[model samples]
Target: MTTRDTTVAVFRPDDERLRDAVELVESLGATPVADPMLEVRETGASPRTDADYTVLTSKTGAEIARETGWEPGETTVCAIGSATAGALREQGYDVDLVPDEFSSTGMVELLAERVDGARVEVARSDHGSQVLLDGLEAAGAYVHETVLYELVRPEGAGGSAELAASGDLDAACFTSSLTVANFLAAAEERGIRADAVAGLADAVVGVIGEPTRETAESEGIAVDVVPENADFDELACAVVERAAPTYHD
Candidate 1:
């Protein structure tokens, strides 16, 4: 009898996130393949002083705000998810709101109800969605944005193209839209975009959230699973369940 070794490609941006994905993959008995497609770096921008409310869409945004020595003061801080709210709390800022749904659209809906005639500051990466800002503006709130971080593809990331096109991977996990976009960009750069896309079509494509799943679909890749919660452990479980039949065969 031969034992099957399942490989799961992890495309998280930074080391901290990659570590979590790797651990989850190992826990599910799958070999973890690091295919980091994006790198997060601070943009050295501070929180806006002219805003009455602040919005954070990711934990990285919260960390960037804290590192820049921005004081929340009386400004109502809104987060998109529990993890982002917890990060703000760790920095001693009282998070005033967190939407039940952890997406920009969800944040917009939450703020639309309470942010009329207010000035809002959106702190996030350079690639952050404009939906929250536009929605707030439509809801009668003046909005400003601070790009606290930037997402860039790491140098020499095309090496993963071979692995991605090899058809040996059992699953691929994407944590963000940028990761999905960058992965395809790297594959295209290596002249293996078609193979990579075909290989992924044959494998289970797991995304951390609906936004990423939508991005994958837009790029012509069919997604197989998306966890209820946008967490690495949940993504791991989803991938493990999808790959179980292959492992046992």
Candidate 2:
């Protein structure tokens, strides 16, 4: 008999990213469950203008910074990843540095040699990692952070939890640490937390990168795939390929 159809769950915001995720799943010949786990709340805050170096960690942060008309001026600009760099460029901001690896650790590594005695401004979300701040400080830079946005789980999430609990899901793609936490929160709200976690143990669970994988595993969710590249398309493609190997158009 033909295998059952593949169904992949994605937890992106309820914006264009989710739409793109749905289309990507469809293109991969798997049914998409678009359950947004996180919502963006802009904080109306921008990075300090007097920093010798400035770091932005997300596309959302970059967009918000540009919207606030925050100029980089003479500050050396840094991005955590290519996506953030691209966002800065699209917002008419020139980016000076992007780490070879797209992570807090990578950002620290890239700046560890140059930021001695410099004033560094890190502007991102409320969930910004301490690793970045601590590393910069240890390297003799005075690092300050501004919260550009906060990520809160949307109200009507967790549909995918039900699907997973019932064994209807083939795979899941988690993009960030917050997404993993919010997904569990949604599952708990639906009273299927245990079952959902058990079901995921049997399914192909893909996370975007090391941090997300650590978050998932810390929650007792066995992550099955993590692409070398820390991006959605890479995560989705790797998950879909594993979940729908025999799927035909």
Give TM-scores for every candidate, taking all chains together and pairing residue i with residue i: 0.93, 0.97
Tens digits of lDDT, candidate 2, 94-129: 999999999999999999999999999999999988
For all candidates, the clash counts are 0, 0
Superpose all Cα atoms of candidate 2 onto the true structure and report the RMSD in Å to 1 decimal: 1.5
lDDT per residue, candidate 1, 126-217, as tens digits?
A: 99887888899999998999899888999877555567688877778888888888888998988899999988888888997888998999
Best by lDDT: 2
Candidate 1 — which residues are off by over 4 angstroms? Answer: 1-4, 245-249
Q: Pick the candidate with the highest TM-score.
A: 2
Candidate 2 achieves a global lDDT of 0.91
User: In model 2, where do residues sit more than 4 Å from their true spots?
Assistant: 1-4, 247-249
Error of 1 at 119 (Å): 0.4
Error of 1 at 227 (Å): 1.5
